[model samples]
Target: MNNRTGAIESVAGNSNFAVNSALSFGYRWFDPERWGHWSFDLDFFGSYMGVGVSGFGMSDHENLGFLGMRGRVGYRVWHDRLEPFIGMIGGSVLANTASGGVDHGAVWGYWFSPTGGVRYYIPNTRWSISLDGFFRFIGGVNGLSGPGVTINEAPHAGLGGRWLYEPVGIVALGYRF
Candidate 1:
């Protein structure tokens, strides 16, 4: 009887350990709890032409460039295997073009982008991938003139939505801490 009781206790202990380990890993990955509901995300991304013309229709505008730093603060709206989130982001786009022996200089613009997305947590694991899209309202391109040129000389302030990429998409890896 004594030996049987000891064996039962040992099995129970091992089962508890396995359960705890699984729970810890899940929390680290999914982070479904509401106690620490705030999350910060950092991402690097590139954009393709959602709109606009390039090079007199010779080619699509080269939209490949550093997308700059993007930071977002999100509250966990719903937490499950797939977590859906809403957040706000701000970043800049620096674009340069060279054509016909002349470097067209750089255009810098700031944007206020509101984002929403969902993260799919892998089954029984702490690894997850997310897809996010943002509608970016960019402004403040007030004084963009080409090299060796003046605003009056260019005859345009370069303001307005000179570049367009609606619903920018991003994929990211994240872990719960």
Candidate 2:
């Protein structure tokens, strides 16, 4: 979430967190045992962003959805039960609405995040869990324009700032075949 509001009227202070839900499908290329304890994966995912979760103190409960893809490389350690990885994800916003603060326009843009994490595979099973952290960069196409609106007079560039930054956390459950 970009902290610098560009022109949107409704003001919501900048916070360090965002709420979202996502699911990912991926394929691993090789067995670590045969590849010197290193593995690589490519994944495609979709997520729904839940802004203003409770709207407890805000005026609007806004939200959106997006799809993205990422690639990760991990190195196994501790008997191959734990692996650490680094990756990058990029995507575009696919949907939005015309209600509530700052983003009450047809918002579309691109975003990317650089991430790092660790995965723990359960013994004797293909199940695994991961925890990751990332910082995302989001930018709009010509600063939030919609029908009957011009970039110069668009109702406050959605989300204000031409670009925004968000620090995000992710937890994922995985299954390998």
Candidate 3:
């Protein structure tokens, strides 16, 4: 009976994890301006994540998902064709979970994340794209779960990193206000 239960649990968990992974994506907008020949940017983005747990005797462990929103303000150190910029980011993650036999289950919680990253912009065009990376510190109450409940687990508070893909790397495309 125990073996059968474990097998059922394993199959259920994998299925949930797959669903979560398929739904992950991030979207953002930004606005940059030049002052004293230095460019400043304000940007915002939303992210969705799904994580699975595997590594213990526990087959009934839960799967996690998060909906996150972030805002950043940055300065361009170099303003040439390949512009390099430094910036600070602040955001919150709305964590949730999916568990318990094909049912979409969730618990609510919030975490604050701070991050920094560099962006490289392609030169000369109101339509340019950039790649940015950042880290976040997560915290809050949405990490715990009860029986038949799915909760989004926060990553250990501290440093984290992400890759940001800007469709139009141009400053005009990402307007702050």
Model 3: weakest 10-residue lDDT segment is: 162-171
User: What's the alpha carbon RMSD for model 1?
Assistant: 24.8
Q: What is candidate 2's local distance difference test score? A: 0.70
Score candidate 1 by lDDT: 0.47
Q: Write the per-residue lDDT of candidate 3 for residues 69-161, one digit (tens) a residue.
A: 444544555553344455554444454443342334444444444444445554554444455544444455443565544333443433353
- Model 3 clash pairs are 30-174, 30-175, 31-174, 128-168, 128-169, 129-169, 135-160
- lDDT tens digits, residues 32-108, model 2? 45789899999997787765532424443445576789889999899889999998998986435332333545567
Model 1: weakest 10-residue lDDT segment is 15-24
| Candidate 2 structure, TM-score to reference | 0.73
- Write one digit per residue (lDDT tens) for candidate 1, span 1-177: 125233322111111110000000112222437546665565554443322233432322223233434555555544546667776655665544443234455566555677888877777776878887776655443343444532222222245424433445667675655
Using TM-score as the measure, the top candidate is 2
lDDT of each: 0.47, 0.70, 0.40
Full ranking by TM-score:
2, 1, 3
Least accurate 10 contiguous residues by lDDT in model 2: 148-157
- Which residue ranges in model 2 land beyond 4 Å of their true spot? 1-16, 53-58, 95-103, 141-161
Residue 133 miss distance in model 3 (angstroms): 1.7
